[model samples]
Target chain A: MKLTIIGVGLIGGSIALKLREKHFVDYIYGVDYSEQHLREAKELEIIDEASPLENAVKNSDLIIVAIPVDSAKKNLESVLALINDQQTVMDVGSTKSGIVQAANLHKNRNRFVAFHPMWGTENSGPKSAISDSFTGRAGVICDKEDSAPDALKMVEQVAEHLEMNLLYMDAESHDVHTAYISHISHITSYALANTVLEKEREEDTIFQLASSGFSSTVRLAKSHPEMWVPIFRQNKENVLDVLNEHITQLRKFKSALEKDNYEYLEELIRNANKIRGILK
Target chain B: MKLTIIGVGLIGGSIALKLREKHFVDYIYGVDYSEQHLREAKELEIIDEASPLENAVKNSDLIIVAIPVDSAKKNLESVLALINDQQTVMDVGSTKSGIVQAANLHKNRNRFVAFHPMWGTENSGPKSAISDSFTGRAGVICDKEDSAPDALKMVEQVAEHLEMNLLYMDAESHDVHTAYISHISHITSYALANTVLEKEREEDTIFQLASSGFSSTVRLAKSHPEMWVPIFRQNKENVLDVLNEHITQLRKFKSALEKDNYEYLEELIRNANKIRGILK
Candidate 1:
């Protein structure tokens, strides 16, 4: 199948690499407003060719709206206006409810499938893309009943080819669960990095004594702001809910520590340790 | 040289494996309060034999205390009572100021060298031990001037044998730096894990939908609480200082998101991205 991946950054570029490597796609056309990213994607051969959005959408069997969440809604609206019943449209945005709502009224709503593959690295841009990025990860297909049967089947086939496990859920459910499990993590990490940076102004000390635990806990703080700010804005309510809960948890811990309530602190940590069973 | 490693859990067991694998020590003796861990350590050949603490200390040329921070101080106090001038002792605890102070007036203070190898994992016990665990990691030797020259030489030799870079710092400096970098990370992770668990309340959702970002950020939450509680207690002041700063940073972020201050959020993330330069 010929596939056109718009905004070929980390997720989009990785998808292009995997599809081309597996021969699931015959020709992959890339489209991005960033001229530098487009140049890098072409130079890296992540896609077969770089083309205008209209040209790529007109010719490809599949059109992937793989951009930042805010930009994704705009692109989805434009693509829905142009795509026909035969060409499948899909998006790999982290936030889904808003995008799904934006395209809900389109006559071609049945052609678009909203998805979020639960995988990513701290790095971004086309240079950071890797082959087989989505393998062994879960791909959430949201509001699939709204999509045409053929469009859903084609997207599922691609997910299967990429070795991704398909999980079905409504767009609202996807946003809520993602806020709880994914989006909040990024915010926590970013806040943590800022915390350490602000409090420990002595960079030399952080550089000297920082261990693997610190690096792992704050790893997501290095994520691209341009990509993530929109996600937090789009999924504002769910993100806020989780954020408030996180702050409350931290306050509880602080109060216990300040009061020298070792027993309470121990119980809290012991409960947190239960996450191990689920993570494994 | 013969070596005795007390408390053959994660740190001690891993050190035993590395020392034996590199042939740094001729015979490795293990001592632990847990009979099961001692048996498992012996079965895994993490030690040549499981010996009583008294016997292990009497026969070994070098003694490594790797128990929980509180137990470490207590054991060091007892060990100091029994040590001869020729027997060199060292510790691999996360915090140092308290341990150093407890051992300061001991007659064998020169024989006791305080060291903290900046390496660990979330998992614990003999099952979690791995060979070459300290390779390429920094090992901090606190108050080296207080240790006997021969004792310092033996510890430095072991660190070099494990391919570790040795750094020298005073006990107070080590405690403060570790609190800022290591202890704070664990607390943040524990709180984050609890936050998500409290809010989501669904095990299946966290397990299935959690992205790499969440897993990485909360990975340290799986750490054994028994080991961490004492570190926090020992380094309470520094930990509290960093914790307060971390909470303040979160509040700043919350206010920014509340007011739709996208520009400030973007700038903050970009600044946090500076960590990438240092980390890499």
Candidate 2:
């Protein structure tokens, strides 16, 4: 089947490459506002051709709106308007509720699937795309009941081709869970990098003494503001809820330290250790 | 040279394994409060034998106080009191200032070398120890001017055998730098883990949706409390200083999001991206 991937950056370009490798799609049409991304995606063979948005949507069997959450919401309306009942549309934005709600009022609503393959890196651009980026990860299809069976099935097939496990959830629930797990992590990393940068004036010390632990915790701070600012904006309420809880939690540590309550501090760390069982 | 390691946990066991591989030590005597650790270290061949503290110190040519910061401070004096001018004593604790100060008034203060290997993982014990753990990482020798030249020279040679880049600084400077680069990262990670654990009641949801980024940011939360509490107690002042700065940094993100200040949020993230140049 022919596929059109909007915003040929990391997520979109990776999906395009994986689908072509699995023979799930015969050709991929790349659409992006940036001409450089389009050229790089085509040169990297991530997509077969670069086409205008209208042409790409009209000529493809599947349309994947893989862009920032704010752009995805606006573009979802335009893509749904252009697609016929025969064409299936999907989006791979980090947050789902706004886009799902935007698509709800569209005439071609049933033809659109709200999907999020739970995988990402700090890096961006088509050059950072990898074919196995989503392998062994969860591919969540949010508000599945809102999409037509055929539309959902095509995305499920794409998830299978990408070697991802399928998960189903409501869009609101997906947004809340991501805010707790994924979104808050980015905030903490960005804040951590800033904390070190503000206080540690000597760059040479950080360069020499940065252990793997420090590097791992601060790695996500390298993410682009263009991507994250939109995510935090679209999921503002949920992000704020978790961010407040996170600050409270941190204050508990501060309180324990201020009072010289080593026992309470140990208890807090021991509680945090519970994540090892859940995550691994 | 014969070596006595006075704590067969992660740091001590790792150094023992690496030094054995380099043939720098013909015999290693493992001493730990936990007999199980000594047995495991012997079985894993991380140490040649398990010996009592007094016997181990008397028989060995060099002594390594590879224990928690609290224990290292108490044991440094004991080891120095037992060792002659011919024997060198060193430590591998996270903080250097407290222990260096504790040893300052000892009669054999010149025989003690304050060292820290800037490499570790959340995993602990002899089982987690690896011979190449310190390779290509920094080995810091603090307050070297206070130590006898021969004692400093022996520790420098040990760093070479471990294949680490050597850096020298005063103990107070090392403590301040680590509080920014290392200790604060752990607190953020622990607090982040607690934030998700406290807010997300559904454990399965976190397991299903936790991305690589979340895992990377919270990996240090798995660190053992026994090892961390002592370090925090000893470096309480510096840790508190950095922790306050970190909380202030996090508050900027909170304030920006609360006011819907996307421009400020973008600026915060862009500023954090500056760390990429320093770290990599």
Candidate 3:
């Protein structure tokens, strides 16, 4: 199949590379607002050619909208407007509710599948893309009933080619779950980074003394604001709910320390240790 | 040299294994409150023999107190009281000020060197120990001026054999710096894990959707309370200070999300990106 990858950056570029490796797509046309990214995508062989959106959508059998959530919503509408009934348009966005809702009113809504692949690194752009990045990660198809069988099947096949475990959920639930599991992590990391930056003036100390634990906990702080601001903005209410709970939990630790309640502090850490069983 | 490692758990077992690998110690005596741990250490070949505290200390030239901060404070004093001028004692504790102060009142205070190896994993026990865990990490010697020159030199040689970069700082400063760089990371991670566990009752949803970023941020939550609670207790004031700053930072994100202040949110994230330069 001829694939058109819109916003050919990390996720889009990765999908293109993986699909091509699996022989799932014969050609990939890269479309992006950034000319440099498009050029890089082509030069890196992440895509076969760089083409205008209208031209790429006209020639391709599938179009994947892989951009920031805010951009993906409008881009999905535009891509859907240009595609025929047989040409499927799917999005790999972090926030699904807004984009899915945006596509609901479109004329070719049935041709669009709302999907999210739960895998990412702190890096961005085509150069950071890896063909096997999504292997064994969850590829969520939100509100699958909203899409036609053919459109959903094609996206499922694409997820299979990327070596992902397929999951189905409603868009709203996906947003809520992601707010707790994914979005809050980024917010905490960013805040933790800011906390250290503000309190620890000596950068050399942080460089020399940072253990793997500190590095792991703050790693996501390196993620770009361009991608994250929209995620927090789009999932504001859910993110805020989780963020409020997170602050409350942190305050509990602060209170425990202030009161010298070692028992309570130990209780809290022991509770957190329950995650070991879940994650491992 | 003969060496005795008090508390034959992760840090102690790891140190014994590495020092043995580097031929720093020809004979190892594993001493711990738990007989099972001593037996495991012997069986794992992390130590050559399991001995009582007095017997181990009398026979060994170097003794490492690798217990929790609270226990290490007492253990250091006891081991110092047992050692002579030729026998040196060192500790590998997360917090420094309390333990260093504990040793200060002892008659053999000058024989004890306060040290911290800046590395750890969430796992615990002799089984969790790895010989090369401290390689390329910082080995901090706190209040080195208070230690006898020969004692300090012996611990420095141990750090060298472990392949660690050596840094010298006072105990007070080490506690404050660690509260920012290390302790706060553990507290944040534990609080984050609690936040997810409290908010997302559906464990399967979390398991399915948790990405590498989420896992990384919460990984330290798995750290044993036996190890972390005393670190927090000893560095309570500094940890509380950093924790307050961290919560304040998190609240800023909350306010920005609540007020739809995307610009401020973007600014917070961009500032956090500064840590990338410091860490990488």
Candidate 4:
């Protein structure tokens, strides 16, 4: 299959790299607003060629939208405008509703499948891409029923080729679930990094002591705001709901410590330990 | 040399296991209040024998107090009371102030070293012990001037054998820094885990959407309360201070989203992105 990856950065680059490694695609056309990223993608050999978005979309069998969510919504509309009946266009944005809505009235709406491959690293760009990054991760397909059977099946086959477990959900529920599981993690991480950065002036002390639990907990603070701001903006209500709940939880922990209610604090931590069942 | 590890759980058992792997100790005495932990420690070969506290302390050349900070402060007093001039004692507690103060006026005060090794896993107990766990990590030794040259040197040598970078600071500073770097991470994680567990009642949704980022961010929430609660209690004031700052940061993020202030949210994440310099 000929694959075209728009915004060939971390997620897109990883998909290109992995799919190419497995010979799932005979050729990959890289498209990006950033010329440097396109050059790097080609130089890293993450894609076979760098092509303009229109040209890439026109020439490829599958076009993957991997830009920021807001941009992705616009680009998906653009891609749907140009794709023929045989071509499939899908997005791998974190937010789903915006993109799905953008294509709802499109003539080729059935050709577009809203996808979110649930995998990433702290790093970004083509250089950060690695082989088999999405293996064993859950790939969420939102509003699958809205898309044509063949279009959905093609994406499912690609996902299976990538070794991901397929999760079917609507766009609204996808946004809500991601707000809790994924987006809020980045928010907490940003808050955590800022918390330590604001108070702990001695960076070396933090560097020395941070490798324990702090590193893992604050790892997502290094995530690119370009990708996340659009996500948080697009899924504002869901993100706000989870963010509000997260703050409330933090306040409870704060009060527990302020009141010297070590028992209550212990209970909170013990309750939090239950995440082990869901996580590990 | 003979080694006695009191409270042979994760930290203690890991130390004993590593020392045994390095052939640094001829015999290791496992001393724990829990008989079950002692039996597990013995079976795991983290200790050469399970013995009573006094018997273990008196028979060893070096004794490591590897319990929670509150327990370590009390146990450090008991261990110091029984140790001779030639024997060296060190406590691997997260907080150093309480442990340091407990031995401040003792005749064997110079014989005890305050140590905090900056490495741990979310898992606990002797079964969780692994060789070379401390390698390439920082080992903070508080109040080196207060310890005898020989005693400090002995513990420093053990740290070197474990391949840890020895960091010397006072007890108060160590506790404050650790609260900012380590304890606050756990608090953030616990709060985050609780927030998701509260809002996302469909545990399956979280399990499906959670990937590396969420897992890493919430991994510390799986930490044992028995180990963390006492550390939080002993370092109550410092923990509260950092927890307040973390909550404040979270509130800023919440408010930014609520107000549709994406620029401020962007700035927060950008500032958080600066942690890339410190972490990676």
DockQ of each: 0.78, 0.91, 0.92, 0.85
Query: After best superposition, candidate 1 residue B183: deviation in angstroms?
Result: 0.9
Please give the clash total of every predicted structure, in order. 0, 0, 0, 0
List, residue by residue over B1-280, the lDDT tens digit for candidate 4. Answer: 9999998988999999888888889899999888999999988888989998999999999999988777788778788889899999998988888888889978899999989889999988888887789999999999999999999999999898889998999999988998889999988898899999999899888887798899999999999888888888888899888888888898898888889999999999999999999987
lDDT of 1 by residue, B5-37 (tens): 999999999988988888888898999999999
What TM-score against the true fold does each predicted structure earn?
0.98, 0.99, 0.99, 0.98
Model 2 clashing-pair count: 0
Give the CAPRI class of candidate 1.
Answer: medium
> Clashes in model 1: which pairs?
none
Model 4, which residues run further than 4 Å from truth?
none
The alpha-carbon deviation from the true structure for residue B88 of candidate 3, after best TM-score superposition, in angstroms, is: 1.0
Q: Per-residue lDDT of A156-210 in model 4, one digit per residue for the tens?
A: 9889888999999999999989999999999999999999999999998888877
Please state the interface RMSD for every predicted structure, separated by commas.
1.0, 0.6, 0.6, 1.0
Q: What digit string (tens of lDDT, one per residue) describes model 1 on residues A62-139?
A: 999889999999888888887888999999999999999997989899999998888899888899999878888999
The digit string of per-residue lDDT tens for model 2 on A1-280 reads 9999999999999999999998999999999999999999999999999999999999999999988888899989889889898999999999999998899998889999999999999899999999999998988999999899999999999999999989999999999999999999999999999999999999998999999999999999999998899999999999999999999999998888999999999999999999999988
TM-score of chain A of 3: 0.99
Clashing pairs in 4: none
